[model samples]
Target chain A: MNLYANDMLGEPIGLLLSLLIGAAFGFWLERAGFGSSRKLTAIFYLRDFAVLKVMFSAMVTAALGLQLLAVTGRIDLAALYVPESIVWPQLVGGLLFGVGFVAGGWCPGTAAVGLASGKLDALVFLIGAGAGSLAFAPLQPRLADFLHAGACSVGSLPGQLGISGPVGALALAAIALAAFVGATAVERIMAKRIAR
Target chain B: MQRPYWNPYVAGIGLGLTLLLSYVVLGTGLGASGGITRIAATAAHAVAPAAIEENAYLGGYFAEGRPLAYYLVTMLAGVLLGGFGSAFAAKRVAIGVERGPSAPASLRLLFALVGGGLAGLGARFALGCTSGQALSGGAMLQTGSFVFTGACFAAAFAFAPLVRKEWR
Candidate 1:
């Protein structure tokens, strides 16, 4: 019954839901070839558009779904937990993460799937990730300002862009559709180049 | 022979539904790095419990000295298990290093480590990785998620050329 388990622990139902949800998350990831590092990093090479296709579709789907639920009064949008929009850290972290993603060949979620599929490199990557996470402890103090800068916990694209939620969702969907088309074209071009 | 992977769009819908279900049930979305961080903290606690207890970034996870009890931790376990089941059924279970034709296994592993390290650091800085930030927060239309996603892809593309031999 306790939906907000972020600050609490030992909630049996919450933990159970976490397991089931994670199972589905991992299952779909593996199904989408995300368990393969090469497949994941293929986006960088413009060789495979699976990552883009999957990510964009997923984002649009969830965005619309959440909007529908909120609009229908089935769920309260404000109750959902979303991280604050801290621009500085996100920008810096995202840039670093991008490098890591391409070089490492897997993100943390996919890396777990990769490890499960018996990839030795995934195990090593996980060790490194753990070490890196631990490494952040010492630097947290110095990075506090940058980390918390522009912290807007409830900020959304719709609110910032001066549009309604549905409008924003439609715009994102449109963008994703265009991107998907572009992704397919890039894939074809890359495939042709590799073929020759 | 291993079966072919699912279509990206189909699998993506499945993933999205799972995320929606997560939000509906848990009032939150999926995550991976947070779990990894806690697991790392747990290991550190085992080695130097007192040190971890006082760690500025990690100390909060030790409130009950049971970092593994969190939702993300359980979710991580499920991710591993579910991935194994799917891969196993598809006959894709193989123990090996994934790298390009010219890259040595050792070199590939080194990249994996370094890359993973950077990703972990970045995830900590941003408070999430692809799962939490890009997918979860992206669906929520959080502005920073888009920024992070944009930055991540841009940086990856920028770095891809330098690491060309690794995946070519």
Candidate 2:
């Protein structure tokens, strides 16, 4: 049994580990210039693609690495907790989140980084987010059923497609590669247009 | 004098490795909204313990006594410290609002607040945010995460023009 699966690590130790990992995550985010709302919102304006590049590359890397570990019997993929699928709520949430991202210029994670960088807007965003989350408690009663709509037993792409995890990971990596190439081309064209 | 940001691919790899480390060590993934929501719940509980306890959503977090004792809260503290350390070292810290030249400071702040509220609400509905659901679950090849991600980008692209003034 692994640390989380068997509760091998006590809660205190687990929490400590999370802190270290979170530090690393924040370090990379700041290094990527995600601490700047300008840099982040540029993706929406089509002036920059760093957000997509960083996110997709990270996704591909983690996916490939996890799949490799699972194949080698180093980690139990089945024992790991995966987020559940709630199709309609997630879809609607995604749309609202997108609009908010463009309007606010930062997501919850990035806003924290932005706040650290001393952006007052980020602070306001955090307060707003907190209030919004609190608001959910009241709305939860009305939206419980809808929020859990389209809940499915098979959650993963590989599970849904009946493909192996490694195969699915490989496909995702290939797609990320293509997107990187296409993103570069688009940035070039958009830059030229702006220059002209 | 601001230092140039790291190459996106390099940073991405670092982030991916960090995420992989989380899974290997903790059997879970990175998240931010959880921390935020927990803070909110804790605050609410302080003022209205009974009300929060009676609420279905807020009560779930309080069931554990201290809502801020969760992993996400600790991680969030790390995020703040790490972010501050990186920015301080790089001299990227500045006290001001960020907005396009064409946009007024007041307008930008308003947008930030409104947009943040929408995002927070959406994250609650979706059960996660970009980091937790999209990136982590996407790496796990979760079907709904991919769908949520696709919908986010599609909607962002579709609605970006409406908010073009804020960013441009």
Candidate 3:
């Protein structure tokens, strides 16, 4: 059975693996409280740290994991897709997305999970996101230009910052560990205020 | 146990492994908005199949038949189901609007709809949202992803208080 190596249709074994991975991926997202819109959006209110906690934790974990695997010669790192740097559009879009996130109480991903968790507002959010996409169809040309602006897809942190990926990953991990500590402190302060 | 959310660090490790599994098996990272775009394609086709035939963005997604039938849609279905499955397992599922006690329910819904609309539109414009850009791309060390994460938090913090009336 030919595995999904770079593009063409993956073999049946590869396909099944995809589903399994997806199931686990989905399961973990749910277990993290990401399926709840309230929990997911709590970061906006500084009421909960799950979004930042889970997200950064996940990022560091994956970065380190992939780095290790690549270093060990287990997986072909070149085959994986690294998102290109389109600074301006993503920056602006992220800002808009963040506002939408706080306003709607869900991100596109969590919104789906929220719907599954029986939140009607999640369904509304999903429809709203879909409509939002349709709304932008009229502005295609402008969006396209902005999307591909400064399209640099080069890989590795060392090249970008003159440091190895491992070094970068370690730095990120340290930051995450610090954040975890800080978040607990914030939660305690919040709990005290609430208790008072 | 109680409330059933795995430890954030533990769950995050699990999620990272899931992403790594996807990469090893499927050769691509995780994504969410891509699934919604597929749904949009199916809808656009239903209204007028030919109109999409000439469009650039929508056209590429249209396959020989059944553009919506694919990996992203299936994975997304799993996301929803998995969420419900976890909520049920944790006994967290409930019916009611979640909002600050002082706010009117109608106002919350209004803002929710508008906020969701903007998020949807922004995802399309930027070609991603938090999942695709912040989480997935962050894992990959993408500069844009990091930038997006920074922008998102800054914007939300700046705007959250301005609209504090809805929640407070």
Deviating ranges (above 4 Å) for candidate 3: A1-4, A9-18, A153-156, B1-4
DockQ of 1: 0.86
TM-score of chain A of 2: 0.95
**TM-score of each prediction:** 0.97, 0.97, 0.92
lDDT of 3 by residue, B93-167 (tens): 776566676878787777778888888877776667787778778877778888888988888888888667666
DockQ of each: 0.86, 0.80, 0.62
Itemize residue pairs with steric clashes in candidate 2: none
Best by lDDT: 1
TM value for model 3:
0.92
Per-residue accuracy of model 2 over B11-34 as CA lDDT, tens digit each: 999999998988898888889988
lDDT of 2 by residue, A19-62 (tens): 88888888899999999998998987788999999999999999
- For every model shown, the clashing-pair count is 0, 0, 2
Error of 1 at A86 (Å): 0.5
Question: Model 1, A1-196: lDDT tens per residue?
Answer: 2286354434877788798889989999999999899889888888898999999999999999999998998888888888888888999999999999999999999999999999999999999999989999999998788889877755798998889998898899999999999999988988798899
